[model samples]
Target: MPRKRYAEDLSVEELRLLLIEKQRARRQKRLEHFRRSGRLVVVDDHPTQPPLETLASRPLSEETPPATANPKHTRLDRLLLAIEILAVLGLAFVLLNGFTLIRDLNREVVAMINQPTLTPTPAITAIVLPGGHTPPNSPGGPRPNDAEIPEHLRPVMLSLPELPTPTPSVEQAIRIQIPAIKVDAPVVQGDGWEQLKKGVGQRLGTPNPGQRGNIVLSAHNDIFGEIFRDLDKLKPGDQVILYSNQRAYVYIVQQTQIVEPTRVEVMAPTQEPIVTLISCYPYMVDNQRIVVTARLQE
Candidate 1:
């Protein structure tokens, strides 16, 4: 081999950059070898390599090779990514019943980790009033159980004019928005139910406004392997808006909860109208179900 050029061969700044380039080239060759050997890798070739300091230090949370990412020649990154993908996919396959199980679970679990956790606050709890505080003539009188509407006991309530005929309008698909990532995915209802696994689905039931229940919708985080790649970037406060019949129903994200595939109670009816968005964790397959619930903004 020819003698290697020393740092003295160039200016100080040039030397630092040249060193990075050398390291990068060495990285590329190794990556090429892996590719030839049929190993999955992160592929990124660049003129300017990251600083040695950067390669040496990092925040622990960002250790993975990235979603659907090609090899960047880092042993740690590649190893971590392989581990994660394997773990997520294996669990999903064991629990869910399909090939896309891993992808689904990855999307859900990863999204959960990426989402903002909302803890109920004592201050908010204090705002709620105890029953029986209202005056006798007040509109909201004391009531033991809310299920008994006072109007049911009055003759005048029966005389109320027949409810206006419901306008016959075609049902429409809902829209989802992710401000932080600039993502706009049309959420088809029920697709989150049984029809889609490692696939997208549209809701089957007509969306009932003010129903005080879960209106579930779902989609594939990724398939044919293109990554949202940023599906993992959905943070708390993300807006999942639904537009139908020329009206936009807004849902403010509350919290992201991860439940085992068998935990069906989380999808149970709520006391207030809310929208539930479900998808596989990480992206692309239904390994685990991620349930994102948002109450309609009053």
Candidate 2:
């Protein structure tokens, strides 16, 4: 009631010492309270947990987790799953299409073999030529039924036979004179019948004088600009005479074609007899072949 004078009312150095003592007393009181309420926690220099004083500062609701579940991880997960599914589908589709194409090609080859073509086709005349005697209606033949012939049957060579037996030559076979076609080049019987022979084909066989299969005879039309000089002038009705052995063999022109050199199938032998003469096409290009199909007449 009167003026109080204790450490609390003293100077700063004395007040700090007094505050420490007061804090110790208050901590003892709290320990007593906790022990009585069965909430006492053991104290050690390095305690397993922080003092209850620190925990008391935070709200109980905040310290603990919420009642709801956690949010999920997504977005990139969905994109990756979709990409995997699409890749599987694309691979399946490609395999299915590839198998289908192979089956179709095999079917086409089988169908080709099954279809028989013995008689000459008027439209496709090289495989089997127009047969029998040329009527009077036919060009270069005697008067017969010239006007009555169908337009499609205008001109065709008779089918070729297997390679004919080499007849005795009236002169050397080396000197083949095709008077109708007027090709007076000497016949050189070898792989090189002509200068362009070496690099033009796949099959390089031993060329016998009288042999079966297609006989490919090639020459440059512009050799010194005079070889096959008369080849382009040949008409369908014109003739190509091969003088071989003692007998002279005659060939009538059937079909003429200008095609890329890659089409080597033209050199394949036909069921019928055929002679194919080939040379570079056009005025200056060597990429295409000018093919002429002919058959022996006599």
TM-score of each: 0.36, 0.37
lDDT of 1 by residue, 30-132 (tens): 8789878989465555547666678545443454455764556577798999999999999987776665777888999999999897754311111111111
lDDT of each: 0.53, 0.53
What is the Cα-based TM-score of model 1?
0.36
Best by TM-score: 2
Clashes (backbone N, CA, C under 3 Å), per candidate, total: 32, 9
Cα error, candidate 2, residue 84 (Å): 68
- Candidate 2 stretches greater than 4 Å from native: 1-173, 191-212
lDDT of 2 by residue, 1-298 (tens): 8898975579875564455557657977997898789898666645465444554444546655776743343667777899999999999999999999999999999999999977653233233111112222335642222233345545532342223334434542344444555676655443222323322211233122234446556655443333454566666756765555566656678888877544556766665545676665554433355778777564
